[model samples]
Target: MERRLIHVITPGDHYSPRTGSAVPTVVHGLSAHAPAGTEPTVLVARGTYPDRYTSADVVEYLPGTEPGRWDRRLDPLRGALGVRRASSRPWAAALHDQDEWPPSVVVLHNAPQAVPLVDTTRHAVVLYAHNELLRTYSPREAALTLGGVTAVVCVSDFLAERTRRRLPPALRDRVAVVRNGVDGTVFRPGRRDASAPLEVTFVGRTIAAKGPDVLLEAVALMDRDDVHVTIVGSSGFSATDPLTPYERRVRAAAEGLRDRVTIRPFLPREAVADQLATTDVVVVPSVWPEPFALTVLEGMAAGAAVVASRIGGIPEAVADGGTLVPPGDPRALADALQVLADSPDRLAAEQDRARRRAAERPWSVVSAELDALLAARLDGQVTA
Candidate 1:
């Protein structure tokens, strides 16, 4: 019997020093909970986690450009110029130098360009989607690539349904809804302060799509001493880029209650989990169709009541753990928070429910599910 390896080819920082993206976080969880004897190696692009500090884990760093070079917008360029998507070709060749041994399962996280390039004959290729399908690839092109894919594992059923609507109906069955899971040990529910004001939190990439501005407006509308806000993470258009006027507007929006709100860049996972643990309520006011709000689930796991946008896969992911508001509506968000803040009993009840919901999607269980799914799709059969 040959040893089977589970390779995770991602283009972001793994959970070593830090994690700023959802796919990396999910990938870290998958690697952490892989079944026994299933050797997991995360193949991430070079410079994705700059400074080159290696962690004691199953990570294989490959050649890649600087942080901003591998943007999804480059997908069209690769297709037009016949350039391969992933920069890990040299590394892959090195790993397969033996020629006889290949990774049994290759889960490509948000690397659409690697789909067609992957040799599906030797390895079971799982297309792990962390975002929308049409955003990077066209319907016909995406459907065509489905021929080589084993399973289109979407983070939420919402993403699965959205992708199915774009692809051929026959390929719909290949779509699977494996909702994102959290490390239960790291993100368990904690005691909340009953006397303190309702503490609200929003954590993600500090972009306009995440709706930090909308959350600010909703907090301003509350106009109460009892409402607190904390928005963490960064977006594009950094200090060097003059093209970002939206960030300027975001700074201006905080002028009204600067003292009441704490808006900072991304923090370490422990710091984030700590914030979620102490928080009374966590808000996800995404203006765009979010594939899945991992922050919402993490907040729920921390026993905090979550208030999020009802669009995309959030409603499905959230289930009964949180209250769903219309996307981009500050007034609706304000109303929901105010109602919860005034009623501690209701807040506590939701917290209990949220914790229970999170327990159902622990990383160990989710990882086992993924391992089973990928193993069954293998071209070569095996028995323990």
Candidate 2:
């Protein structure tokens, strides 16, 4: 494998070291560690995070009306692009003004606004799909934006299928699935603390789509007092903003289980891994379809039984490794919790299954897969 420059472009910041969001983490993961003879670089328009795992070369922030998703000023763009953050167009144009060598490949993550970059250089563009198509462009816009793209690498098969349907049939040929993976080394197993109470955790944003509310309801429904629940992550997108209304609602919902439930704010990736390591169960109760929840893989890597929503690409990861319940149903979630509670042996079996599944692929393995896809497309082979 000869060395090649790979560039990842995301509309929002790729954070310095703040590692809660899945997209930035994946970008950082790919950028931080490249296979033999490869160089990776990241470009972002806005990010306050300064301690990135990888060296971020692009950090030109632009002014914006508000923080987080649903900025009404760019509401139309969000409806079409499916990203909360604004475009990094200004910095991107400046970067490619051509004093520097253009990347051989450009990965556009969640920003349809930057699709114009395809014309800036001959670099093979990949529109990395991370969510359903509704948040992205319409069929015609998709065809126009992705006209010169080498491929549209989806985070999961569910998203892949949705993406294919979003474009014209001619453009559909470019769609493919490259499932998200976790860092096995950082999320590896730890000794189970049997002395500690049975710890279960729900890690992700506290948004309505994430279904933290359902998890809290399920926790309150569980009759057993031995369970210790921890909900890690805050409600808003900004790292420094006040608690969001959603977070307040979740807190009010968990009022009954105040003593048993611990609402933990978001921690560093290392700390999140530590939390997953000791946790007996990791719940991802997302009501909306998640393209791929990396936390599920991290939990499985840590030898924890994962309980996630059966929607979207989740089944691709949780299959036979843990449990899945219908989305937005607290009763179903409670029932699944009872299953884990009633049978420690069964939970252990699930954990074993998960650990084995997680071991099948590391972040490096996945990055290599992506690199191979890029190589194929760049070589004019379109059978992705």
Candidate 3:
């Protein structure tokens, strides 16, 4: 049997080696898993940053012509039309033009803003939901679009359940849970220095949903001078949006503890790994239900004693691999940090388990499962 060609559509500025978002990671993993002779193409929204992944084939859809580059805001009224227009350009045109060959599957990675124009091409359409679109959409709009989707791929069981709860009954059956996997090879644990003060790191967007405020508050409660926290990632949504509510709160929380709390813009992927190498513990105190916390998996892979709130897909990802605390509870988070900081023996034992847990979730294993699922869908053995 001939292998199937898979086309991925994402809202993300794709193929950046340094980008650590789940959509990009999934694309990379799928490319690595594609069978020989099976073509996999990614369609990404054009961005200001230059193309970073030279090796991977990409189709950049210039949504609009801003001075510096393409921005989503350019054609806000007809974003889906813009993506469809770009898809017909040289890069993606071949897929549609080739009469002898047609895409076996069309996978959408959170492009709800532009999903209306997605070309199904009589192939299986899978929309990977990384977050709740209903929360952002009006009731009628959510019902129409979400109901029309052929199949829904959720990153976590928690998210699947949540989505189902919100969706109309007719749309619930289309949802399927497919958890995200980590690159163990790159994120594995490194040798720790005993002399260094305990390093606690949080890597993610500086947004309210990420719970940066919760993290800072928890650190303040600890009141331990020896412990250090590093907050990495950008917050200001350009000059127009300015700082987000969560970013403002995080900034305010770090005021007095400026010496202990280090806030910096996003770092490259390798730099993030470098930070993880020296990290004693990684804290993910997300106040919202994270569909899947990729950073938690990264931290576990890097051998940090993971401390995260027991919410969303986090508990599913950690699964006895690391420390779990109640979300939004500063005292509980501080207590967990204090326990890890004060007891090296306990942290070491947990670190071993965390590493082992992370090692079990390799991209190869995940890709195999995805391939089989897609195959089943194509064979008509599975209903959307």
Q: Model 1's lDDT to the true fold?
A: 0.72
lDDT of 1 at 184: 76
82-108, model 3: which lDDT tens digit per residue?
A: 323232233333234333435455676
Native-vs-model 3 lDDT? 0.70
Model 1 per-residue lDDT tens digits across residues 1-384: 232544554544544536556766777777677778676665655555553323214444555443245644575666445554444344353234223445466677765555665666666667888888555555666666566788888988889888788677777788887888987777766666778778899987667888989999998999988888888766641223343467567767877786778776668777788888898888999988888888887888888888999988888779978899999999999999999989988988888888888888888888888777766665355222
Superposed Cα deviation of residue 76, candidate 3 (Å): 15
Q: What CA RMSD would you report for each candidate? A: 3.8, 4.1, 5.3
Query: Comparing candidate 1 with candidate 2, which one achieves the higher TM-score?
Result: 2
Q: Write the per-residue lDDT of candidate 2 for residues 277-360, one digit (tens) a residue.
A: 888999999998888888889999998988999998998877677788999999999998888777888878888989988887
TM-score of 3: 0.81
List residue ranges in candidate 1 displaced over 4 A.
1-5, 15-17, 46-61, 64-100, 135-140, 236-244, 379-384
Candidate 1 TM-score over all chains jointly: 0.85
Pairs that clash in candidate 2: 3-37, 16-49, 16-51, 16-52, 17-51, 17-52, 80-136, 82-135
Choose the strongest candidate by lDDT: 2
lDDT of each: 0.72, 0.73, 0.70
Ranking, TM-score, top scorer first:
2, 1, 3
Deviation of model 1 at 253, angstroms? 2.2
